[model samples]
Target: MLETIRGLLEGKPGDAPAVLAPERETLDYASLRDLCDRTVERLNALGIGRGDRVAIVLPNGPEMATAFVAMASAATTAPLNPAYREEEFAFYISDLGARALVVAEGMETPALAVARRHGARVLRLRVPAGAPAGWFELEPEEGGGAPRAARPGPAEAEDVALVLHTSGTTSRPKIVPLLHRNIVASTRHIGEALALSPADRVLNVMPLFHIHGLVAAVASSLAAGGSIFATPGFDAIRFFRWLDESRASWYTAVPTMHQAVLARAARNPEIVERRRLRLIRSSSASLPPQVMRELEATFGCPVIESYGMTEAAHQMTSNPLPPRPRKPGSVGVPAGPLVRIADPSGRFLPAGEEGEVAISGPNVTPGYESHPKANAEAFFEAEGRRWFRTGDQGRFDADGYLTITGRIKEIINRGGEKVSPLEVDNVLMEHPAVRQVVTFALPHPKLGEEVAAAVVLADGAEVNEHELRRFAAERLADFKVPRKFVFVTEIPKGATGKLQRLGLAQRLGLVE
Candidate 1:
C-alpha cells in the first residue's frame, strides 16, 4: 500500500484537475500537490507535525477535502463536525487534546471558543479569490500555544494520519486513530472495488468530516488519479443538475440522501436521460432493497451497497462492479479486510450461522486510542489473526455474501424473541405508500422491548398505521411485526446523515 495520501498524486498527469469545486477553478494535480506541500511546511513551521493532533472545523467543499489531505501528510488530522454546539465542541476538543484548530478565515464557529478554552492554537485558513479551488494560506492567531514538534516533516506508515470519534450510540464515543497504512490500504481497496482510473470522476455529496467522505469520496478517487467534484453538502434539488452538468461517472451517499434524490427524480427525466452514471454507491447505512430497486430502475445503473465504519477507515466490504453478480440486499463480499462471523466466545462461526461480525486486515485500526478497557474489549485474537469485533450481528451465506441482520445492541428482544430491525424495515418498505421506514426497539413494561417503526410516507401518499401493520403481519411473524407505528415527515439523522437506530426511541420520545 502507498505510505501517505500525498503519494497518491504521484505518477499522475500534473495538469489534470484533481479537486473540482462548484463555480470555482479546479485544483489540478500539480496545484493540489503544491498546496499540500505548502500546507505541511506551514504546519511544520508552527511546530505541529506527526503525533500532534489538529482539529479541523470547516464547511464542506474543496477546502475541507484538500485540508484533510494536507494535514494528514504532516500531522494527525481530526476533522470535527461544524454543526456541533459549543458544549459539544468543548468536549471533543478537550478529548482529542488538539494542539491546534483549523477553520476558514473570518468564519465564526463555536470551535474557536472551545479551542481557546483548551489553550489550543488557532490557525485560520484563507482561500483567496481566483486561487486554485483547494489552495489556501494559514495564519496563526496571536499568542499561539507552545509548539509540540521539534522538526516537522511528512509522516511514516506507522504514524497516525487521522483520529475520529465513534458515534457512541450506546456508550461514550471512542477515539479511533487510523495510521497511514490503514488509510492507504482502505483507499486502495475502495479504488479497486470501484475500478477507478484517471478518467473516473466522483461527485462527492457525503459530509467531509465522515470517513465515508474522507476516504470513499476524496481519498479513493484521488488515489486512482481521478477528480472529485466537491459539493458544499447534499441538496436533493440540485443533485440531478450536478450529476448532469458534471458528467460524473459515480456518486456515493447514504440511503436517506438517495431517498431524497428519488423523491425529486420523478420531475427530472431529461437530466436522468442525459446523465450516464456508471455506478451509484450506498454506504454508512443499509440501502433498503426497495430503494435500491427504484434507483436501478430509474437510472439504469447498478446500486452498489458497501459496509463500512470508522474503525475500518471506511470500506470493509463492497458489492463488486459489473460482470460480477450483486446480491440485492447483501453488502456483498469482503472487499478490503478479512471478514468473518464470530460467536460471543470469540470463536469464528461457519457459514449460515449468525453472530457478531469481526474484521481483521491492514485497514482495521490498530485499536481505539487511550482507552485500555475499550481496546481490550474490542480486539481479540482468532485464527492467528487479530480481529476487531464490529458489534454488528450478521451472517455469511454459502456463496460468501454477508447479510447484516442488525446491530447487536439494537436488536429488539421481545420476551426473549430477538428481532432484526432490518427485516422489519425491508418488509414495511414493500408497502407502496411507505417511502422510508426505521424499525426500533420501543420500551415495553411487560415484554422488556417491543418492536416499533417510524415511517415517512411517499409524496401525497397516505396509508394508515393499521394498514401498514397488517401489511407487515402478512410478511413477518407476529412477534417481528411493529406494534407502534409513528408517522413522521422525516426521521432523525446523525451528523453524517446516518439514521440512528439505537437511540431512535429517545429521539422519537417513545422512551425515557
Candidate 2:
C-alpha cells in the first residue's frame, strides 16, 4: 500500500485522469505527480518542509484538492473552511502555529489579515485559465524570506500529513494530527472496501477540508489509480448536470446532500439514466434508512452507508458491495479498524450489547495532538491493546452489523431512563407527514433532561406537536416520546451539514 500521498500516483498510467474541475482541463496522473513535485520544490524554496504546518484556504474545487495532496506530501496540511469568519480564521491560524498560509491569487479572504496578525507568510496561488486543473504557481508575498527548514523530500510514514480540528459542537475544538501511515492505511482500506479501480470515476461534491472528501474521495481514488471529478461544492440544482456530463461511476455525499438530490430526482430522468452509478456512498453523518431505500430505488444501485470521523482518518466501517449481505440501518461491519464494544471503564462487551464503540487499528490516529487529558479519556489500555473510544454509542448484531444508536453525550436521560435519539428519529421518520427530523434533549427542571425534537414537514404535509407526539406515543414508550416538539422548516446543521444534537436546545431558544 502507498504510505504517503505522493506514492498514491505510483505505477499509474500517466494519461489517466486524476483530478477534474467542472469545464476545466483534466490533470492526468503523470501531470498530477509532476505538479506535486513542482509544488513541493516551491514549498521547499519558500522554507516549508515536513513537520512544518501550512494552512490552506481556497475555494472548493480542483485547486483545493490538488493543493491538499501536494502540500501534504512535504508539509503538514491544515485546510481551513473558506467560509470561516475573521475570528475563526485568527483562532485556527494561531492555534495551528502555522508557518505559512496559501490562498488563491485574487482571494481576498479575512484569513489573509489573520495570517498577518500571526506573522504567517502569505503566498498567492496563480492558476492560468488554460492550464490543467492541478497546475498552479506559488507566489510569495512581495519581498519575504520565510523561516527555513532542512527537510525537503517525501515524508515517511510517521510524519504528520494532516491536522484538523474537531467540530467541537459541545466544547472547545481539539487539534488532531494524522500521520502519513494513518491516512494511507485509511485510503487503501476505503478503496478496497469500495472495490475501486482505474475504470471507476468518483464525483466529489463534498468540501475539500473535511475528512470525508480528503480520505474517502480524493485519496482513495488516487490510491486506486481512478479519477475524481471535483465539483465546486454540493449544489442540488447543478448536481444532476455534473453527474451526467462527468459520467461518474459513483459518488459520495452526506445525508443532507443525498436528501436534497433525492428531492430533485423525479424531475431529472435523462440525467439519471445517462449516468448509472455503480454505487452510492453516504457518510460523515448517519444516513436515514428511508432516504437510503429511496436512493436505491431511484438509482438502481446499492447505497453503502459508512461510518467515519475526523480522528479515524475518514473511514471506520462500510457496507460491503454486492454478494455480501447489506443490512439497512447498520453502518456495516468494520472495514479497516478492529471495532469492539466497551463499557465506560473499558471492559469489552459481548455481541447484542449496547456500549461505546472502540477501535484499534493503523487507520486510527495515535492520539489527539498534545492533549493529555483528552488522550487519557479518549484512549484506554484494554486487553493488551490501546483502544480509542469513538464517543458513539452502538452495538454489534449477531450477524456482526454495527448499528450506531447515538452519541454518548447526546443520549437523552429522562428521569434516569436512557433514550436513544436515533431510535426516536427512526420512528418519527416513518410518519408520512415528517420529512426531516432531529431528536435532541431539552433541559428539564425536575428530570434534568427531557426528550425533544425539531422537525421539517414534507411539502404540503402538515403536522403539529400534538399529532407528532401521538404518532410517537404509539410506537414508543411514554418516556421516549418527545416532551417538546418544535415544528421548524429546517433544522440547524454544522459546518459539514451534520445535525448537531448537542447545544441545539440553547440555539433554538428553548433553554436559557
Query: What lDDT score is found at residue 94 in candidate 2?
Result: 93
In order, the Cα lDDT scores of the candidates are: 0.91, 0.91
lDDT of 1 by residue, 1-512 (tens): 25788788788899998998777888899988888788878888888988889999999999999999988888999999999999999989999999999999999999999899898889999988888778889899875555646647877789899999998777899899999889999999999999999998999999999999999999999999999999999999989878886789999999999989998988999989888788999998888899999999999999999999999999999999988998888999999899999998899889999999999999999999889999899999977899999989999999999999998988999999999999999989899999889999999899999999999998899989899989999999999999999999998888878887887888888777
In terms of lDDT, model 2 sits at 0.91
Residue 232 shift from truth in candidate 2, angstroms: 0.9
Candidate 2's error at 441, in angstroms?
0.6
Estimated TM-score for each candidate = 0.98, 0.98
User: Model 1 off-target regions past 4 Å?
Assistant: 143-148
Superposed Cα RMSD, model 2: 1.1
Off by over 4 Å in 2: 144-148
Residue 456: error of model 1 in Å?
A: 1.0
- Per residue, candidate 2 scores C-alpha lDDT tens digits across 1-512 of 26888888889999999998788888999999888888888888788899999999999899899999999878999999999999999899999999999999989999999999898889898998799886788898867675556788777789999999998777789999999999999998899899999999999999998999998999999999999999999999999999987889999999989999998999998889878999999998888889899999999999999999999998999999998988888999999989999998899999999999999999999888779999999999987889999999999999899999999998999989999999999899889888889999998889999999999998899778999999999999999999889988788887778877888899899888
Residue 285 of model 2 has an lDDT of: 82
